[model samples]
Target: MAQLTSIHRFPVKSCRGESVGSAVVEPWGLAGDRRWMVVDDAGAGITAREVNRLVLVHPEITDGGLRITAPDLPALEVPTPDPARQVPVAIWSSTLTAAAAGAEADAWISKALGVAARLVHLDDPTRRPTSPAFSEPGDLVSFADGYPVLLTTEESLAALNDVVLASADTGRDPLPMTRFRPNVVVSGVEPWAEDDWRRIRIGDAVFRAVKGCARCVLTTIDPDSAVREKEPIRSLAKIRRWDGATWFGINLVPDTYDVTIRVGDEFEVLEAVAPGSGPLRPAP
Candidate 1:
Protein backbone atom coordinates (compact mmCIF):
# COMPACT_ATOMS: atom_id res chain seq x y z
CA MET A 1 0.00 0.00 0.00
CA ALA A 2 1.04 3.53 -0.69
CA GLN A 3 -0.14 6.86 0.66
CA LEU A 4 -1.38 9.65 -1.53
CA THR A 5 0.97 12.41 -0.54
CA SER A 6 -0.48 15.25 -2.57
CA ILE A 7 -3.31 16.29 -4.90
CA HIS A 8 -2.49 18.92 -7.52
CA ARG A 9 -5.02 20.87 -9.54
CA PHE A 10 -4.04 22.71 -12.67
CA PRO A 11 -6.95 24.97 -13.63
CA VAL A 12 -5.14 25.87 -16.81
CA LYS A 13 -3.30 23.30 -18.88
CA SER A 14 0.53 23.39 -18.78
CA CYS A 15 0.56 26.29 -16.33
CA ARG A 16 1.52 26.26 -12.66
CA GLY A 17 -0.50 23.88 -10.49
CA GLU A 18 -1.75 24.23 -6.94
CA SER A 19 -1.53 21.51 -4.34
CA VAL A 20 -4.75 20.91 -2.45
CA GLY A 21 -5.48 18.78 0.56
CA SER A 22 -8.44 17.18 -1.19
CA ALA A 23 -10.03 17.32 -4.62
CA VAL A 24 -13.44 16.38 -5.91
CA VAL A 25 -13.33 13.76 -8.66
CA GLU A 26 -15.33 14.58 -11.76
CA PRO A 27 -15.89 12.34 -14.74
CA TRP A 28 -13.58 14.50 -16.79
CA GLY A 29 -10.96 14.79 -14.02
CA LEU A 30 -10.53 16.44 -10.66
CA ALA A 31 -12.82 19.45 -10.35
CA GLY A 32 -11.34 22.40 -12.30
CA ASP A 33 -8.33 20.45 -13.53
CA ARG A 34 -7.19 21.71 -16.92
CA ARG A 35 -10.57 23.12 -17.84
CA TRP A 36 -8.84 26.18 -19.29
CA MET A 37 -6.11 26.45 -21.90
CA VAL A 38 -4.06 29.00 -23.80
CA VAL A 39 -4.18 28.90 -27.55
CA ASP A 40 -2.60 30.61 -30.50
CA ASP A 41 -4.47 32.97 -32.85
CA ALA A 42 -5.11 29.93 -35.04
CA GLY A 43 -6.93 28.40 -32.07
CA ALA A 44 -4.15 25.85 -31.59
CA GLY A 45 -3.14 24.91 -28.07
CA ILE A 46 -0.06 26.55 -26.53
CA THR A 47 1.76 25.11 -23.55
CA ALA A 48 4.81 25.82 -21.44
CA ARG A 49 6.55 23.29 -23.61
CA GLU A 50 6.71 26.06 -26.21
CA VAL A 51 6.39 29.21 -24.07
CA ASN A 52 8.42 28.80 -20.90
CA ARG A 53 7.11 32.00 -19.30
CA LEU A 54 3.66 30.41 -19.19
CA VAL A 55 4.79 28.57 -16.09
CA LEU A 56 4.82 31.92 -14.34
CA VAL A 57 1.14 32.55 -15.08
CA HIS A 58 -0.75 31.63 -11.95
CA PRO A 59 -4.50 31.19 -12.17
CA GLU A 60 -6.17 31.44 -8.82
CA ILE A 61 -9.56 29.74 -8.72
CA THR A 62 -12.27 32.27 -8.03
CA ASP A 63 -15.98 32.10 -7.27
CA GLY A 64 -17.06 33.06 -10.76
CA GLY A 65 -13.93 31.97 -12.65
CA LEU A 66 -10.17 32.54 -12.53
CA ARG A 67 -7.87 35.33 -11.35
CA ILE A 68 -4.78 35.09 -13.52
CA THR A 69 -1.63 36.53 -11.89
CA ALA A 70 1.97 36.63 -13.01
CA PRO A 71 5.23 38.13 -11.85
CA ASP A 72 5.41 41.93 -12.35
CA LEU A 73 1.99 41.97 -13.97
CA PRO A 74 -1.38 43.14 -12.81
CA ALA A 75 -3.78 40.27 -12.08
CA LEU A 76 -6.80 39.82 -14.32
CA GLU A 77 -10.11 38.24 -13.39
CA VAL A 78 -11.57 36.14 -16.16
CA PRO A 79 -15.15 35.06 -15.86
CA THR A 80 -16.51 31.86 -17.32
CA PRO A 81 -17.51 32.30 -20.90
CA ASP A 82 -21.05 31.43 -21.82
CA PRO A 83 -21.37 27.77 -22.68
CA ALA A 84 -23.62 28.67 -25.58
CA ARG A 85 -20.77 30.60 -27.16
CA GLN A 86 -18.16 28.01 -27.98
CA VAL A 87 -15.51 28.42 -30.66
CA PRO A 88 -13.46 25.83 -32.50
CA VAL A 89 -10.03 25.15 -30.97
CA ALA A 90 -7.29 22.70 -31.81
CA ILE A 91 -5.68 20.38 -29.30
CA TRP A 92 -3.05 18.33 -31.00
CA SER A 93 -4.96 17.11 -34.07
CA SER A 94 -8.38 17.24 -32.47
CA THR A 95 -10.75 20.12 -33.13
CA LEU A 96 -12.83 20.82 -30.04
CA THR A 97 -15.26 23.57 -29.05
CA ALA A 98 -14.47 25.86 -26.14
CA ALA A 99 -15.65 29.20 -24.76
CA ALA A 100 -13.33 32.10 -25.45
CA ALA A 101 -12.59 34.26 -22.42
CA GLY A 102 -12.97 37.46 -24.49
CA ALA A 103 -10.49 40.04 -25.75
CA GLU A 104 -9.51 41.26 -22.28
CA ALA A 105 -8.20 37.86 -21.31
CA ASP A 106 -6.50 37.36 -24.64
CA ALA A 107 -4.72 40.68 -24.30
CA TRP A 108 -3.74 40.12 -20.68
CA ILE A 109 -2.22 36.71 -21.26
CA SER A 110 -0.64 37.80 -24.51
CA LYS A 111 1.00 40.77 -22.82
CA ALA A 112 1.98 38.63 -19.84
CA LEU A 113 3.95 36.27 -22.07
CA GLY A 114 4.80 38.79 -24.81
CA VAL A 115 3.03 36.57 -27.33
CA ALA A 116 -0.21 36.52 -29.21
CA ALA A 117 -2.34 34.03 -27.28
CA ARG A 118 -5.97 33.52 -26.32
CA LEU A 119 -7.47 31.85 -23.31
CA VAL A 120 -10.33 29.41 -23.71
CA HIS A 121 -12.42 27.37 -21.31
CA LEU A 122 -13.85 23.90 -21.64
CA ASP A 123 -17.52 24.80 -21.49
CA ASP A 124 -18.44 21.16 -21.21
CA PRO A 125 -16.21 18.58 -19.65
CA THR A 126 -17.82 15.80 -21.66
CA ARG A 127 -16.93 17.43 -24.95
CA ARG A 128 -13.79 15.32 -25.34
CA PRO A 129 -13.55 11.56 -25.06
CA THR A 130 -10.48 9.74 -23.88
CA SER A 131 -8.42 7.99 -26.50
CA PRO A 132 -10.31 4.86 -27.61
CA ALA A 133 -7.07 2.92 -27.67
CA PHE A 134 -6.71 3.07 -23.89
CA SER A 135 -10.18 3.92 -22.52
CA GLU A 136 -13.60 2.35 -22.54
CA PRO A 137 -16.43 4.04 -24.38
CA GLY A 138 -18.13 6.94 -22.55
CA ASP A 139 -14.90 7.86 -20.72
CA LEU A 140 -14.27 11.61 -21.02
CA VAL A 141 -11.63 14.20 -20.21
CA SER A 142 -11.15 17.96 -20.05
CA PHE A 143 -8.30 19.99 -21.59
CA ALA A 144 -5.65 17.61 -20.25
CA ASP A 145 -3.27 16.01 -22.71
CA GLY A 146 -5.05 12.64 -22.64
CA TYR A 147 -6.10 10.87 -19.46
CA PRO A 148 -8.06 12.14 -16.48
CA VAL A 149 -5.32 11.84 -13.85
CA LEU A 150 -1.55 11.48 -13.95
CA LEU A 151 0.00 9.51 -11.08
CA THR A 152 3.63 9.54 -9.95
CA THR A 153 5.37 7.91 -7.05
CA GLU A 154 8.03 9.46 -4.84
CA GLU A 155 10.06 6.27 -4.77
CA SER A 156 10.38 6.24 -8.54
CA LEU A 157 11.48 9.89 -8.60
CA ALA A 158 14.02 9.22 -5.88
CA ALA A 159 15.49 6.35 -7.86
CA LEU A 160 15.73 8.53 -10.94
CA ASN A 161 17.36 11.36 -8.96
CA ASP A 162 19.94 8.94 -7.59
CA VAL A 163 21.00 8.03 -11.10
CA VAL A 164 20.99 11.70 -12.09
CA LEU A 165 23.30 12.64 -9.21
CA ALA A 166 25.74 9.89 -10.18
CA SER A 167 25.94 11.08 -13.76
CA ALA A 168 28.54 13.66 -14.79
CA ASP A 169 26.66 14.72 -17.88
CA THR A 170 23.61 16.16 -16.10
CA GLY A 171 23.45 19.29 -13.89
CA ARG A 172 23.89 16.92 -10.91
CA ASP A 173 20.94 18.57 -9.16
CA PRO A 174 17.90 16.55 -8.06
CA LEU A 175 14.63 17.56 -9.69
CA PRO A 176 11.34 18.14 -7.93
CA MET A 177 8.16 16.22 -8.74
CA THR A 178 6.61 19.50 -10.00
CA ARG A 179 8.63 19.19 -13.20
CA PHE A 180 6.47 16.19 -14.12
CA ARG A 181 3.19 18.00 -13.24
CA PRO A 182 1.40 14.97 -11.89
CA ASN A 183 -2.12 15.24 -10.46
CA VAL A 184 -1.73 12.57 -7.82
CA VAL A 185 1.59 11.97 -6.10
CA VAL A 186 1.96 8.78 -4.07
CA SER A 187 4.62 7.86 -1.53
CA GLY A 188 5.93 4.84 0.37
CA VAL A 189 6.19 2.55 -2.63
CA GLU A 190 9.06 0.68 -4.22
CA PRO A 191 10.74 2.28 -7.19
CA TRP A 192 8.67 2.02 -10.38
CA ALA A 193 6.03 -0.12 -8.61
CA GLU A 194 3.35 1.67 -10.63
CA ASP A 195 4.49 -0.15 -13.74
CA ASP A 196 2.47 -3.21 -12.68
CA TRP A 197 -0.71 -1.45 -11.57
CA ARG A 198 -3.74 -2.51 -13.60
CA ARG A 199 -6.31 -1.36 -11.05
CA ILE A 200 -5.93 0.47 -7.81
CA ARG A 201 -7.97 2.16 -5.07
CA ILE A 202 -6.95 5.42 -3.46
CA GLY A 203 -9.21 6.45 -0.63
CA ASP A 204 -12.75 5.92 -1.92
CA ALA A 205 -11.85 6.37 -5.55
CA VAL A 206 -10.94 3.46 -7.81
CA PHE A 207 -8.84 3.88 -10.94
CA ARG A 208 -7.67 1.79 -13.86
CA ALA A 209 -4.14 2.35 -15.05
CA VAL A 210 -4.44 2.83 -18.77
CA LYS A 211 -1.02 3.92 -20.08
CA GLY A 212 2.53 4.79 -19.08
CA CYS A 213 3.42 8.49 -19.19
CA ALA A 214 5.93 9.23 -21.97
CA ARG A 215 7.96 12.25 -20.90
CA CYS A 216 8.89 15.16 -23.15
CA VAL A 217 11.03 18.30 -23.02
CA LEU A 218 8.39 20.06 -20.86
CA THR A 219 9.77 18.20 -17.84
CA THR A 220 13.07 19.96 -18.35
CA ILE A 221 11.49 23.37 -17.67
CA ASP A 222 11.46 24.69 -14.13
CA PRO A 223 8.02 25.90 -13.03
CA ASP A 224 9.45 28.35 -10.51
CA SER A 225 12.28 29.86 -12.54
CA ALA A 226 10.86 29.33 -16.04
CA VAL A 227 14.38 28.21 -17.02
CA ARG A 228 14.92 25.24 -19.29
CA GLU A 229 17.58 22.67 -18.46
CA LYS A 230 18.65 19.16 -19.45
CA GLU A 231 17.90 16.87 -16.59
CA PRO A 232 15.50 14.09 -15.56
CA ILE A 233 15.29 13.59 -19.30
CA ARG A 234 19.06 13.26 -19.49
CA SER A 235 18.91 10.62 -16.78
CA LEU A 236 15.63 9.07 -17.95
CA ALA A 237 17.04 8.35 -21.38
CA LYS A 238 19.56 6.10 -19.68
CA ILE A 239 17.17 4.11 -17.49
CA ARG A 240 13.69 4.60 -18.91
CA ARG A 241 14.07 4.76 -22.66
CA TRP A 242 11.84 2.33 -24.51
CA ASP A 243 9.54 2.41 -27.54
CA GLY A 244 11.62 5.39 -28.70
CA ALA A 245 10.54 7.58 -25.74
CA THR A 246 11.65 8.27 -22.20
CA TRP A 247 8.93 7.08 -19.77
CA PHE A 248 7.97 8.03 -16.26
CA GLY A 249 4.81 7.85 -14.10
CA ILE A 250 1.45 6.47 -15.34
CA ASN A 251 -1.97 7.69 -16.54
CA LEU A 252 -5.19 6.67 -14.80
CA VAL A 253 -8.92 6.81 -15.52
CA PRO A 254 -11.32 6.85 -12.63
CA ASP A 255 -13.91 4.08 -12.42
CA THR A 256 -16.26 6.24 -10.42
CA TYR A 257 -17.17 9.91 -10.01
CA ASP A 258 -17.71 12.36 -7.16
CA VAL A 259 -15.15 10.49 -5.09
CA THR A 260 -13.10 12.86 -3.00
CA ILE A 261 -9.47 11.87 -2.62
CA ARG A 262 -7.45 13.51 0.11
CA VAL A 263 -3.79 13.73 0.90
CA GLY A 264 -2.58 10.97 3.22
CA ASP A 265 -5.22 8.66 1.79
CA GLU A 266 -4.23 5.04 1.73
CA PHE A 267 -4.01 3.45 -1.70
CA GLU A 268 -3.86 -0.25 -2.54
CA VAL A 269 -3.28 -2.11 -5.75
CA LEU A 270 -6.13 -4.50 -6.49
CA GLU A 271 -4.69 -5.90 -9.68
CA ALA A 272 -1.21 -6.05 -11.15
CA VAL A 273 0.62 -7.38 -14.18
CA ALA A 274 4.09 -6.88 -15.58
CA PRO A 275 4.13 -4.17 -18.24
CA GLY A 276 6.09 -4.31 -21.47
CA SER A 277 9.75 -3.52 -20.92
CA GLY A 278 12.00 -4.10 -23.89
CA PRO A 279 14.97 -2.00 -22.79
CA LEU A 280 13.91 -0.22 -19.59
CA ARG A 281 16.34 -0.64 -16.68
CA PRO A 282 17.47 1.10 -13.51
CA ALA A 283 20.45 2.54 -15.39
CA PRO A 284 22.35 1.85 -18.57
Candidate 2:
Protein backbone atom coordinates (compact mmCIF):
# COMPACT_ATOMS: atom_id res chain seq x y z
CA MET A 1 0.00 0.00 0.00
CA ALA A 2 1.22 3.47 -0.82
CA GLN A 3 0.86 6.41 1.57
CA LEU A 4 0.63 10.13 0.90
CA THR A 5 3.31 12.06 2.73
CA SER A 6 2.83 15.62 1.51
CA ILE A 7 0.41 18.04 -0.14
CA HIS A 8 1.30 21.29 -1.91
CA ARG A 9 -0.45 23.99 -3.87
CA PHE A 10 1.15 26.76 -5.86
CA PRO A 11 -1.24 29.72 -5.62
CA VAL A 12 0.52 31.42 -8.45
CA LYS A 13 2.31 29.97 -11.45
CA SER A 14 6.06 29.39 -10.95
CA CYS A 15 6.09 31.10 -7.56
CA ARG A 16 6.54 29.50 -4.17
CA GLY A 17 3.96 26.85 -3.32
CA GLU A 18 2.22 26.59 0.04
CA SER A 19 2.54 23.33 1.90
CA VAL A 20 -0.96 22.52 3.06
CA GLY A 21 -2.41 19.89 5.35
CA SER A 22 -5.33 19.45 2.97
CA ALA A 23 -6.83 20.98 -0.15
CA VAL A 24 -10.06 20.82 -2.14
CA VAL A 25 -9.67 19.17 -5.54
CA GLU A 26 -11.45 20.90 -8.39
CA PRO A 27 -11.54 19.65 -11.97
CA TRP A 28 -8.74 21.89 -13.15
CA GLY A 29 -6.73 21.17 -10.00
CA LEU A 30 -6.42 22.17 -6.35
CA ALA A 31 -8.99 24.93 -5.66
CA GLY A 32 -6.57 27.79 -5.08
CA ASP A 33 -3.67 26.62 -7.21
CA ARG A 34 -2.70 28.61 -10.27
CA ARG A 35 -6.13 30.21 -10.68
CA TRP A 36 -4.66 33.65 -11.22
CA MET A 37 -1.57 34.59 -13.21
CA VAL A 38 0.41 37.74 -13.90
CA VAL A 39 0.28 38.89 -17.46
CA ASP A 40 1.70 41.82 -19.41
CA ASP A 41 -0.46 44.75 -20.56
CA ALA A 42 -1.04 43.08 -23.93
CA GLY A 43 -2.47 40.04 -22.09
CA ALA A 44 0.62 37.90 -22.56
CA GLY A 45 1.32 35.54 -19.67
CA ILE A 46 4.52 35.79 -17.60
CA THR A 47 6.29 33.08 -15.63
CA ALA A 48 9.51 32.43 -13.69
CA ARG A 49 11.10 31.42 -17.00
CA GLU A 50 11.15 35.01 -18.25
CA VAL A 51 10.89 36.84 -14.95
CA ASN A 52 13.08 35.03 -12.46
CA ARG A 53 11.99 37.62 -9.91
CA LEU A 54 8.53 35.98 -9.91
CA VAL A 55 10.17 33.28 -7.80
CA LEU A 56 10.52 35.84 -5.03
CA VAL A 57 6.78 36.58 -4.96
CA HIS A 58 4.91 34.50 -2.43
CA PRO A 59 1.15 34.21 -2.01
CA GLU A 60 -0.82 33.24 1.08
CA ILE A 61 -4.54 32.91 1.76
CA THR A 62 -5.90 35.35 4.30
CA ASP A 63 -9.20 36.05 6.01
CA GLY A 64 -9.98 38.71 3.44
CA GLY A 65 -8.75 36.74 0.41
CA LEU A 66 -5.30 36.23 -1.12
CA ARG A 67 -2.35 38.20 0.14
CA ILE A 68 0.81 38.46 -1.97
CA THR A 69 4.24 39.71 -0.91
CA ALA A 70 7.36 40.29 -2.97
CA PRO A 71 10.82 41.55 -2.19
CA ASP A 72 10.30 44.91 -3.88
CA LEU A 73 6.78 45.91 -2.75
CA PRO A 74 4.44 45.93 0.21
CA ALA A 75 1.96 43.11 0.56
CA LEU A 76 -1.24 43.40 -1.47
CA GLU A 77 -4.53 41.72 -0.62
CA VAL A 78 -7.27 40.80 -3.09
CA PRO A 79 -10.69 39.50 -2.23
CA THR A 80 -11.71 36.20 -3.83
CA PRO A 81 -14.56 37.60 -5.82
CA ASP A 82 -15.61 36.59 -9.30
CA PRO A 83 -14.10 39.81 -10.59
CA ALA A 84 -16.33 41.99 -12.78
CA ARG A 85 -13.79 42.39 -15.56
CA GLN A 86 -13.09 39.51 -17.96
CA VAL A 87 -10.40 39.04 -20.57
CA PRO A 88 -9.02 36.47 -23.02
CA VAL A 89 -5.66 34.92 -22.21
CA ALA A 90 -3.49 31.95 -23.04
CA ILE A 91 -1.92 29.36 -20.75
CA TRP A 92 0.41 27.07 -22.64
CA SER A 93 -1.41 25.96 -25.79
CA SER A 94 -4.93 26.53 -24.50
CA THR A 95 -6.71 29.80 -25.17
CA LEU A 96 -9.00 30.80 -22.32
CA THR A 97 -11.37 33.56 -21.34
CA ALA A 98 -10.67 34.45 -17.74
CA ALA A 99 -11.57 37.10 -15.19
CA ALA A 100 -9.29 40.02 -14.50
CA ALA A 101 -8.95 39.26 -10.78
CA GLY A 102 -7.92 42.57 -9.23
CA ALA A 103 -6.45 45.87 -10.31
CA GLU A 104 -4.73 46.05 -6.94
CA ALA A 105 -2.91 42.78 -7.69
CA ASP A 106 -1.77 44.27 -10.96
CA ALA A 107 -0.53 47.42 -9.29
CA TRP A 108 1.47 45.46 -6.73
CA ILE A 109 3.04 43.17 -9.31
CA SER A 110 3.81 46.02 -11.69
CA LYS A 111 5.49 48.04 -9.01
CA ALA A 112 7.54 45.13 -7.74
CA LEU A 113 8.60 43.67 -11.07
CA GLY A 114 8.94 47.08 -12.68
CA VAL A 115 6.70 46.02 -15.55
CA ALA A 116 3.21 46.90 -16.71
CA ALA A 117 1.01 43.94 -15.78
CA ARG A 118 -2.38 42.67 -14.66
CA LEU A 119 -3.81 39.70 -12.77
CA VAL A 120 -5.98 37.39 -14.88
CA HIS A 121 -8.21 34.72 -13.36
CA LEU A 122 -8.96 31.61 -15.38
CA ASP A 123 -12.79 31.68 -15.63
CA ASP A 124 -13.71 30.14 -18.95
CA PRO A 125 -16.64 27.79 -18.52
CA THR A 126 -15.73 25.89 -21.67
CA ARG A 127 -12.13 25.51 -20.59
CA ARG A 128 -13.31 24.29 -17.21
CA PRO A 129 -14.33 21.07 -18.95
CA THR A 130 -11.81 18.28 -18.52
CA SER A 131 -10.02 16.50 -21.31
CA PRO A 132 -12.20 14.09 -23.25
CA ALA A 133 -9.85 11.23 -22.45
CA PHE A 134 -10.53 11.56 -18.73
CA SER A 135 -13.84 13.44 -18.55
CA GLU A 136 -17.07 11.81 -17.54
CA PRO A 137 -20.33 13.76 -17.78
CA GLY A 138 -19.65 16.13 -14.88
CA ASP A 139 -15.89 16.58 -14.64
CA LEU A 140 -14.87 20.16 -13.82
CA VAL A 141 -11.51 21.77 -13.17
CA SER A 142 -10.30 24.98 -11.57
CA PHE A 143 -6.72 25.59 -12.75
CA ALA A 144 -3.83 23.14 -12.88
CA ASP A 145 -0.87 22.37 -15.07
CA GLY A 146 -3.23 20.09 -17.08
CA TYR A 147 -4.69 17.67 -14.54
CA PRO A 148 -6.06 17.30 -11.03
CA VAL A 149 -2.90 16.30 -9.19
CA LEU A 150 0.66 15.37 -10.11
CA LEU A 151 2.06 12.26 -8.43
CA THR A 152 5.72 11.36 -8.05
CA THR A 153 7.03 8.48 -5.99
CA GLU A 154 9.88 8.98 -3.55
CA GLU A 155 11.71 6.04 -5.09
CA SER A 156 11.87 7.87 -8.39
CA LEU A 157 13.39 10.87 -6.72
CA ALA A 158 15.86 8.63 -4.94
CA ALA A 159 16.77 7.06 -8.23
CA LEU A 160 17.24 10.50 -9.76
CA ASN A 161 19.20 11.66 -6.76
CA ASP A 162 21.65 8.86 -7.28
CA VAL A 163 22.16 10.04 -10.81
CA VAL A 164 22.44 13.63 -9.61
CA LEU A 165 25.03 12.75 -7.00
CA ALA A 166 27.01 10.64 -9.43
CA SER A 167 27.09 13.43 -12.00
CA ALA A 168 27.53 16.48 -9.78
CA ASP A 169 30.86 18.15 -9.06
CA THR A 170 32.21 17.31 -5.58
CA GLY A 171 30.63 20.09 -3.50
CA ARG A 172 26.90 20.29 -4.37
CA ASP A 173 24.24 18.74 -2.14
CA PRO A 174 21.85 16.11 -3.48
CA LEU A 175 18.62 17.49 -4.94
CA PRO A 176 15.31 17.38 -3.05
CA MET A 177 11.89 16.38 -4.42
CA THR A 178 10.84 20.03 -4.17
CA ARG A 179 12.80 20.48 -7.37
CA PHE A 180 10.05 18.50 -9.11
CA ARG A 181 7.17 20.18 -7.21
CA PRO A 182 4.70 17.32 -7.28
CA ASN A 183 1.34 17.69 -5.53
CA VAL A 184 1.49 14.17 -4.14
CA VAL A 185 4.59 12.21 -3.09
CA VAL A 186 4.09 8.51 -2.50
CA SER A 187 6.54 6.42 -0.51
CA GLY A 188 7.47 2.69 -0.28
CA VAL A 189 7.26 2.18 -4.00
CA GLU A 190 9.85 0.99 -6.49
CA PRO A 191 11.68 3.54 -8.56
CA TRP A 192 9.27 5.11 -11.05
CA ALA A 193 6.44 2.84 -9.89
CA GLU A 194 4.03 5.76 -10.09
CA ASP A 195 4.30 5.64 -13.85
CA ASP A 196 2.18 2.50 -13.82
CA TRP A 197 -0.44 3.44 -11.28
CA ARG A 198 -3.93 3.04 -12.77
CA ARG A 199 -5.76 4.45 -9.77
CA ILE A 200 -4.79 5.63 -6.33
CA ARG A 201 -7.14 6.16 -3.39
CA ILE A 202 -5.92 8.63 -0.81
CA GLY A 203 -8.33 8.82 2.07
CA ASP A 204 -11.66 9.27 0.25
CA ALA A 205 -10.18 10.85 -2.85
CA VAL A 206 -9.32 8.68 -5.85
CA PHE A 207 -6.97 9.91 -8.56
CA ARG A 208 -6.60 8.24 -11.94
CA ALA A 209 -3.21 8.28 -13.61
CA VAL A 210 -3.70 10.16 -16.83
CA LYS A 211 -0.28 10.72 -18.42
CA GLY A 212 3.39 11.36 -17.82
CA CYS A 213 4.27 14.96 -17.02
CA ALA A 214 6.94 16.41 -19.27
CA ARG A 215 9.50 18.33 -17.23
CA CYS A 216 11.09 21.67 -17.91
CA VAL A 217 13.60 24.15 -16.45
CA LEU A 218 11.17 24.66 -13.57
CA THR A 219 12.48 21.38 -12.23
CA THR A 220 15.94 22.94 -11.96
CA ILE A 221 14.70 26.07 -10.20
CA ASP A 222 15.13 26.01 -6.43
CA PRO A 223 11.65 26.45 -4.92
CA ASP A 224 12.80 28.10 -1.69
CA SER A 225 15.09 30.71 -3.23
CA ALA A 226 14.41 30.65 -7.01
CA VAL A 227 18.04 30.01 -7.80
CA ARG A 228 18.93 27.80 -10.77
CA GLU A 229 21.45 24.98 -10.80
CA LYS A 230 22.95 23.10 -13.71
CA GLU A 231 24.07 19.75 -12.30
CA PRO A 232 20.65 18.16 -11.74
CA ILE A 233 19.29 19.32 -15.06
CA ARG A 234 22.34 17.96 -16.78
CA SER A 235 22.08 14.75 -14.79
CA LEU A 236 18.39 14.29 -15.47
CA ALA A 237 18.98 15.02 -19.10
CA LYS A 238 21.48 12.20 -19.17
CA ILE A 239 19.23 9.72 -17.36
CA ARG A 240 15.53 10.55 -17.83
CA ARG A 241 15.07 12.33 -21.12
CA TRP A 242 11.74 11.57 -22.77
CA ASP A 243 10.56 12.72 -26.19
CA GLY A 244 13.38 15.23 -26.32
CA ALA A 245 12.35 16.61 -22.90
CA THR A 246 13.33 15.55 -19.40
CA TRP A 247 10.23 14.57 -17.34
CA PHE A 248 9.02 13.53 -13.94
CA GLY A 249 5.75 12.90 -12.08
CA ILE A 250 2.51 11.38 -13.37
CA ASN A 251 -0.42 13.60 -14.30
CA LEU A 252 -3.69 12.60 -12.59
CA VAL A 253 -7.44 12.53 -13.10
CA PRO A 254 -9.41 12.49 -9.87
CA ASP A 255 -12.55 10.39 -9.48
CA THR A 256 -14.56 13.52 -8.71
CA TYR A 257 -14.05 17.23 -8.81
CA ASP A 258 -15.19 17.71 -5.22
CA VAL A 259 -12.66 15.45 -3.50
CA THR A 260 -10.39 16.91 -0.84
CA ILE A 261 -6.86 15.67 -0.15
CA ARG A 262 -4.65 16.06 2.89
CA VAL A 263 -1.18 15.19 4.06
CA GLY A 264 -0.79 11.85 5.87
CA ASP A 265 -3.65 10.48 3.79
CA GLU A 266 -3.22 6.74 3.35
CA PHE A 267 -3.21 5.65 -0.29
CA GLU A 268 -4.45 2.33 -1.60
CA VAL A 269 -2.83 1.55 -4.90
CA LEU A 270 -5.41 -0.31 -6.96
CA GLU A 271 -3.41 -1.50 -9.95
CA ALA A 272 -0.17 -1.10 -11.82
CA VAL A 273 -0.28 -0.71 -15.55
CA ALA A 274 2.65 -1.00 -17.97
CA PRO A 275 5.77 0.82 -16.83
CA GLY A 276 8.35 2.46 -19.06
CA SER A 277 5.82 2.65 -21.91
CA GLY A 278 5.29 6.38 -22.15
CA PRO A 279 7.19 9.32 -23.64
CA LEU A 280 10.73 8.94 -24.91
CA ARG A 281 13.63 10.20 -22.83
CA PRO A 282 15.69 13.12 -24.01
CA ALA A 283 19.17 12.36 -25.37
CA PRO A 284 21.94 13.61 -23.12
Query: Considering every candidate listed, which one attains the maximal lDDT?
Result: 1
TM-score of 2: 0.89
Candidate 2 displacement at residue 236 in angstroms: 1.5
- Which residue segments of model 1 deviate by more than 4 Å? 168-172, 275-284
Model 2 is weakest, by summed lDDT over 10 consecutive residues, at 275-284
Positional deviation of residue 40's Cα in model 2 after best superposition, in angstroms:
1.6
- lDDT, candidate 2, 18-51, per-residue tens: 8888888766677777777788876778887777
Number of clashes found in candidate 1: 0
Provide the TM-score for each candidate, comma-separated: 0.95, 0.89
lDDT of every model, 2 decimals: 0.89, 0.73
Put down candidate 1 lDDT per residue, 179-223, tens digits, no spaces. Answer: 999999999888988887878889999988888899999999988
* Number of the top-ranking candidate, with TM-score as the measure: 1
